[model samples]
Target: MKIAIIGTGNVGSALAQRFVQSGHQVSFGVRDASSPKSQKASTIAGTTLLSIEEASKLAEVIIIATPPEAVLSLVAQLGDVKNKIIIDTTNSIRTRPEPYATAYHALKEITKSNKIVKCFNSTGFENMNNPIYSDFGGIDMFCAGDNKEAKALAQNLAKQIGFSECWDFGGDDKVELLEKFALSWINLAIMQGHGRNLAFKVIKRA
Candidate 1:
């Protein structure tokens, strides 16, 4: 899979490394390819750096790991994403793309694309870097979207990156709920002092 990660921050960098390690083509999409963050991400093996428009145009999957508010301007630079899978990995906790509750909503409305999924927004970047726990194995991931194809791809990508399972959190109407779910993790791990190493996993009893 050709994956373009927008935003060279922790979440973006971590996912880029894991996706590359999983045998996928990874690229960092940035406003400035020479920026420190972009340069650091380029250090990862099997990854390329390009402008946001170039990377988005070349990718099959585009992961938005940038601040939620940035999505407004980013849509213009994303080229034509109508045929690509867009994964919204941003949370609207501190800020959001005004007029839209979350980045997922923003992308869907602005791009007018149904291939959008809200994912990888529910945990810390450390968990994304390494989802494995010694005793329990890979932790869980979650995704929500109206597009079945996009959701399936998001789930598959999650598993490829070491998540044990990527649960479906319902469709488009449930996106805001999923973002709230992310806030729950933030509350437990940061506000409640549970620590960043903690992760969520679902267990079934049969």
Candidate 2:
């Protein structure tokens, strides 16, 4: 997969490194390649740094790991994304794109693209860096979207990064619900001091 990560923050860099290690071609799309964050992400082997537009053009999949509000301005830079798959890994807990409830909503409406999915937002960057636990093996991931193909691709990417499963949260209406799920993790891991080493997994009895 030719993946373009739009941010170079903790979550973005973590996924980028894991994806690169999984043998996928990764590129970082940034406002300034020389910026500290972008420079740091560029240090990852087998990855390239390019302007936002350039990176978007070269990628088959575009992962938005930036702040939720950043998607408002990114609409213009994400040229011809109609044929590409967009995986939104943001939660609008602190700030959302105006006129839209979430970054996923903003991207779908502004870009008029149906191939969008909300994913990789339900846990901390530590989990994304390493989903495997000594006991549980691989933690589960969750994704929500209306497009079946888009959701399938998102689930595949999650597994490629060592997630055991990428459960389907639901259709478009469940996007916010998934964000709220992320908040639950934040509350436990940060507010309640449960520690970032924790993760969630679904259990079933056969």
User: Number of clashes in every candidate structure?
Assistant: 0, 0
Clash number for model 1? 0
* Least well predicted 10-residue stretch by lDDT in candidate 2: 32-41
Name the best candidate (by lDDT): 2
Over the full model, what C-alpha lDDT does candidate 1 score relative to the true structure? Answer: 0.94
Per-model TM values vs. the true structure: 0.98, 0.99
- Which whole-number lDDT from 0 to 100 does residue 22 have in model 2? 92
Tens digit of per-residue lDDT, candidate 1, span 32-135: 88889988988899999999999999999999999999999988999899899999999999998998998899899999999999999999999999999999
lDDT of 2 by residue, 24-49 (tens): 99999999888899989888899899
Model 1, residue pairs in steric clash: none
RMSD values for the candidates in order, in angstroms, are 0.7, 0.6
Q: How many angstroms is residue 116 displaced in model 2 relative to the true structure, after the best TM-score fit?
A: 0.3
